[model samples]
Target chain A: MASSIHDLARHLNISIGTVSRALNGRADVNADTRQRVLEAARTLNYSPNQSGRSLRQGATHSIAFMLQPHPGDQQYGEPFFIPFLIGLQAKLAESGLDLIVVMGAPGDYQQERLRRVVETRRADAVVLAWTRREDERIDYLTQAGFPFATLGRSRSGAKSYPSLDLDFEKAGADAVDRLVARGHRRIAAIRPSLNLNFAYLFLDGYRKALRRHGIEVDPELIASGFINEAGGYEVTPHVMRSKDPPTAIIFNNDAMALGGCKALAEMGIRPGHDMAVTVIVDTPLCRYFSPALTAFRPALEPMGQRLAEMLLASIPAFAGPQGPRIMREVWPLELVARDSD
Target chain B: MASSIHDLARHLNISIGTVSRALNGRADVNADTRQRVLEAARTLNYSPNQSGRSLRQGATHSIAFMLQPHPGDQQYGEPFFIPFLIGLQAKLAESGLDLIVVMGAPGDYQQERLRRVVETRRADAVVLAWTRREDERIDYLTQAGFPFATLGRSRSGAKSYPSLDLDFEKAGADAVDRLVARGHRRIAAIRPSLNLNFAYLFLDGYRKALRRHGIEVDPELIASGFINEAGGYEVTPHVMRSKDPPTAIIFNNDAMALGGCKALAEMGIRPGHDMAVTVIVDTPLCRYFSPALTAFRPALEPMGQRLAEMLLASIPAFAGPQGPRIMREVWPLELVARDSD
Candidate 1:
């Protein structure tokens, strides 16, 4: 594990800087060279000393995943983050990169912790998950010259950065199409916070799907913001109270759906039979819920793999000619049929 | 954020080495000195450079959580870790220690990962969660002289380390008493793999509870096993096939119970009516499951906080006089009664 870059370069027939660069994911190196360097390092048991390597290449072979836990985290039963974490860790484990989950203190969250992680050079790269549409972390990471990848897309629309996201737009449209096919015309949708880029995509999918069915997008029918349990719980009551309440409701996640169900039960409504409910991100618990929840399951492992690969390839000191490329890998959710709409 | 140890020492009227020792969690520094040193550093916005400081003090203000992705992790719906993480993270955030989750690759689980994490100095302290009867990780961590803590107890009889565990024995005994009170003389229990230290504790609890009722221990009624959904699925049938099947059953977790329920339903058994069922570790999904699951619910926040506090205190650099102490905290689970029991 102490084998140096010199030994690695000598064994691989490459220059020391190239070895260091390849190890660090630098763009100047090429893909094949980086591969050889990595293979050689592994064969020789050369896990770099993070301290010394950081001084030379500004790399720590570690990435931090930051999360902001609101009250809704528990209400939703912590569904999204766990699978997402499993996917990310599974991919990064192959490259011997460690993942640090940085949870903020009461007052500070992602942006604050990110600054600490980057400014202190604690990691070779940073991964931003669940990005807001105008994410401050994206801008900070970019301006700070740290290689980063977001599980969600940035609003900047830069082609240089790496990002991997779910095909929410397709899932949203498919959900609407499925519900519409079931003879439900008045369909309503719930979305994540409007500030989140994915929420925009979710809304876009809903609009596009409705348009495909020759229905005009109704602003009143869409409930956005913190689309968590509280969000679902709060929004459903309003939707049900509307003069023309929709018979069918689409939820972004099972938590929201669960919350919505509670609201429905309060109003003497049976979710699947009286008011159709469909959700995205089918958690395992959804199967146990009364009127088993029907949801669209995204390919989490692939998404996590793509993000890890992009982040690994983007490290400036270790990247090859196949340098950090702006990659957008989106997997559409597969519908998992259950008792619920 | 980049204030060096020298600047901190100068500002706080301390020696450079003292400042370094204080920041690095060294035991040599007195409690008062360490406190003053930490306060001054914070006031001056001194965020230590992990690389340089690590070279000098052999420490990194970070901790790693190792996870083995067993099939049961997904089946249990991963209810425990998330809340545990929230608790751990919330506490550690105050001390500015980051939590690194190390997911083991297929073949090499904990022991191998610990060697690398410690040898590489990736973390100043390594946290071993879910201990076994004679945990290899615990021995290694102790031998390596690396500051460490565990989320479970060790069987070594030597309480030299910090641990915070749930009172599984109490939970198990409680389940038995509750079932016995419900007029069930024949009871069955599904335990975790006996190799796990907690499993033994869980079994002990079950035995003690039965003894409380003056019932002789029935070896055939206790299932020592790989107690996941599959284990439950496979074991329940055998129990039922026995010449004298148990009228009441206790499960280690919701996952195993859910599996047992499936096995029961397959045999046209009506749980909670035909046979009583009780489980530990109540999860959010259990509520929606038909005939809501009755299980023991531990206060996860307190458990996590204890672990984080212990790990934080164990750090050699920042630990004050009230420094890292070997403490054991065991919280009894609060029973949530439901239809299942």
Candidate 2:
């Protein structure tokens, strides 16, 4: 059996606390004592109980991230997750908080999982990436009185939770405006699932842009699909086969844009030549594509950092607000015109 | 301030233990009493210190996952992560262990993070993915006496660790055999970093297969790149433009295969017709590609399940060798013939 802290304490004829401090690399432990304990532990192959120590320390210094279930096998092409993680990690690095990612089923009672994290003290706080309408996870966290911040907002109201999200509607509108400015009258919008609040918001922005341009919104030009490459690829054939196909297609995300590019290639249609494609979420891969993809920049790193800060602050009691605090920050989507658009 | 367990105890006129039991849904507490305690806690918006409870229980019922850093943007088009995650989650669901994933930069001492989890009691055991040659993480875990199982084997051997891994060499050799059987002598192998143990093994398999078929191993045909889609795409133009490009190209992974497919499409060289492409790790998206991808099955789900079970068993004292206990299981990589090859 591996030696425990108690066994080490006995072997060294020292208190368990002193041995623990040495093992934990605590500053209080004398160098000689620390070395002794370390040497002994090295020989005995001792593994201490970390959870117990964290409880005594009053902080786990860890953040929990729960992933929403991906419905299909389609890989989401966007590198949004990496930037978001980088941003979160950048901030957490300062405070010595490590990110602990968790993948949960879509229909799974995520609230229970969140509660468990808090109940077990596995994390000091949680950062929720995917937000849904009437999010029970948010509500349960709120009701259970745990601190958390979401990447997206709930449709019900901003008063209910703290979230950091791009003005998706504005982003969608910007895409349409960019297409219209390029002298493309008939533009199609590929939106994400309607289940998400941002999906509806983006659609509204598209409609608003069309109305401002005095161009009637064509329902046939709008299609909803998963925010992935395949989603974009699958819908391309449908749009191109249409009798009055739009000259420009705006995608909800970059993954779909990749698919859209592939579809155009298949149909012997050059995206920037025969048809224009603008994708939201400017990722590094966009620049590497054959023609280089045109996309909107959300600056995900900053967004992730802001969200982490908001969640950290929201954990303590707020003196000003009775309802849940709402902090809204809208980043301008810079249209990086590449060959595809 | 949010109500605490003590506050709930005061409000319900019950002991802290009773309140805790009720909150934890322990069967020992009377259902009626549990309901009343729960109701009072809910009304007060009580949230107990989860860390403290976890320490007391001596189990966090969570699993820790650690990944080694890769060169370039960590979020490159690597389809392996998502599927591996899905498989891990599927096993976790059955075992009721919440997964806590941590990504660390290469050469970073992850032992501190592992210690923190154990000391804080945030997790019962750890599942280490993507093991490398001479992995310090494995040594640290073994010396520290923490329970952990690896996704891939370490150079030291499996006697010190339990691992679920593919017969990378066999997979590589089989690809060559298949291509050779199809009357192809000139072949190119797109390899990942040769520094990696698995990559070297795969190259060895490739060499062995070529030798059996009396074909000399051409160093010029072996292009080393990152195992990602963009890497595949980036290499395509160069490979296609080469004066003596092979008729068949075998990718290290599926993401790269897709990139190769896209590149072939761009060059007006139809995959499966003009150039054969084969990738490792089969998934549903392979079938949807323009020329559906021919690939190897990694059996990720079963591997995850087995790893979880092994880790769980190792948590307690096991009478065995003191050095690394290595266990390697090779799942057959069934070839799925598709349009791509």
Candidate 3:
């Protein structure tokens, strides 16, 4: 179980260089010697170290998924990644590839982290999440000619790359249309303060939906919060304090919505009955809430599996017989209605 | 930014073998030649690939953490790991080492995963969680002479190893004592059906505490769940249907407790008023739940940091001036009294 190449050479009573050449299948090594070396290696359970093998093959046989750091010392924004990672890992396993999660360092070191992973040849490909509108990391990976796939779409890299993005824009507009149909005129949206590509896309659809209804989009009705429960708790009252507060509100995530609901309960405003609420749910938190939340649920596990497949398609070694195809897909979401809205 | 060793050698008008020898500081290479190669490598922005360098040094300079898979196809049990991972990555970064999360495959493939990580030299050390009583994984690592640290204590392996464990035994007893003080006699416990070491330790403490008060242990009062919300929701009524039902219940985790609370509400029973409730909290879920839950909070982020420190202390390369020391510690939990109990 703990045998090495040196041990193999010693046990076979052969020169170290001869054993290496025989194992590496060099033309100079005799066939009989190669067979003997292989048999001994199998018997000794001598698994070649990945470092030595990767050096010769120039492939790590591992894919890295960058876990983006949130603002400050906060935890990653969503619990959805746990299932997503499981799915990604399962798919990668089919190709005999290992999935390594590379955590982004705090603050602006994210780009540096990506560069190190690429420059050091730690992985053959990478999967990026928490994409920004103008992601320098994407641009860096693209210009460096490193293989990568993204969880969200970005408008940064010059060359198109494989990406699996949620239909966030459609979800946003649908939320607005649903509220408008329920006889709500003033609608509010709570999004992350960060300049994420999805947040911008969501607002685009929300504003467009308002215009389609001939309703004016008010600046006061749009609020930005940190992407956490406390952020939602703190911003709920601020948005409610507007001169003419919105009767209906849509939160960017379930965690924030949970906090907003708690804040509303303390303010004596009952959700569903008094103030209509909707959330972009990724976890079961909304399902078990006191008043089950109306949510747009994305099938995260399947999406994660697709993300891995798309990434593999872009890597020439893992691609199909037709060769590598850089794909771009917008995953669909299902709207589940509950008492909250 | 994408310079390779071949490009450097071609630019310097030297043989590739000569350049390699100079960079690796071989005795055969002259000092002047080595100095010239180093300066040219820096000027070209050439970063040595980790595979080649690690083969020579016998070190990957990376740590692998095993994210234990839960039962069936369920997501990893808790979201508390997000902050915990962030803490670990930050601490590892201090030593110029990277943290790579290795996801355990479904079913009984965990030991195989650990073996691959070690045999392939993918990481210099490992961090294991979801420890079981007499865990074979621990025994395997200890026997293989691999550096590792556990998040929970285990009664496995011939030699001692570094571990940072929670005081689950005390927490279980404290919960019972607190309930007893509040005039409760029949207390039910909901633990994971899995044979986790913590669950066993927790139940041991619970049983001892009930006996301390001269109360006989009732088999009907103990319940087992799948470590998720649905598991909690499903088992709540079953435990309540006992011939002589318990007046109070303690859930192993917050997600299950949240589901149990919902189930109680549907049955016309309020958590704090009709039945006392307590949870071993790892996330912010219980704090924001209606009738805020009584919980024991472990400082997860700092605990993660400490776990990293302990693991590094065991690795000779990362150890302090005094050399590697195998440390074992039990982390304390703070009981937060909420409205639920």
Best candidate, DockQ: 3
Q: Among all windows of ten consecutive residues in candidate 3 chain A, which has the lowest summed lDDT?
A: A69-78
lDDT of 1 at A40: 89
Q: Weakest 10 consecutive residues, lDDT, candidate 2 chain A?
A: A70-79
Report, for every candidate in turn, its global Cα lDDT versus the true structure.
0.75, 0.71, 0.84
Interface CA RMSD, all predictions: 4.3, 4.2, 2.1
Cα error, candidate 1, residue A190 (Å): 4.2
Estimate the TM-score of every prediction.
0.79, 0.82, 0.90
- Residue pairs with clashing backbones, model 3: none
Per-residue error for A202 in candidate 3, Å, reads 1.9
Off by more than 4 A, model 1: A1-49, A74-87, A93-96, A156-159, A186-192, A214-247, A259-276, A288-292, B1-48, B71-77, B215-248, B258-276, B287-292, B312-318, B322-324
- Candidate 3, which segments miss by more than 4 Å at Cα? A4-41, A72-77, B1-42
- What lDDT tens digits, residue by residue, belong to model 3 across residues B108-204? 7388899999988899999988788879999999989899999888889954789988999989998999999999998999888647888888898
Name the candidate, 2 or 3, with the larger DockQ value.
Answer: 3
TM-score of 1: 0.79
For candidate 3, the lDDT comes to: 0.84
Ranking by lDDT: 3, 1, 2
Predicted candidate 1 versus true structure: per-residue lDDT over B210-234, tens digit per residue: 8888998887787754445566777
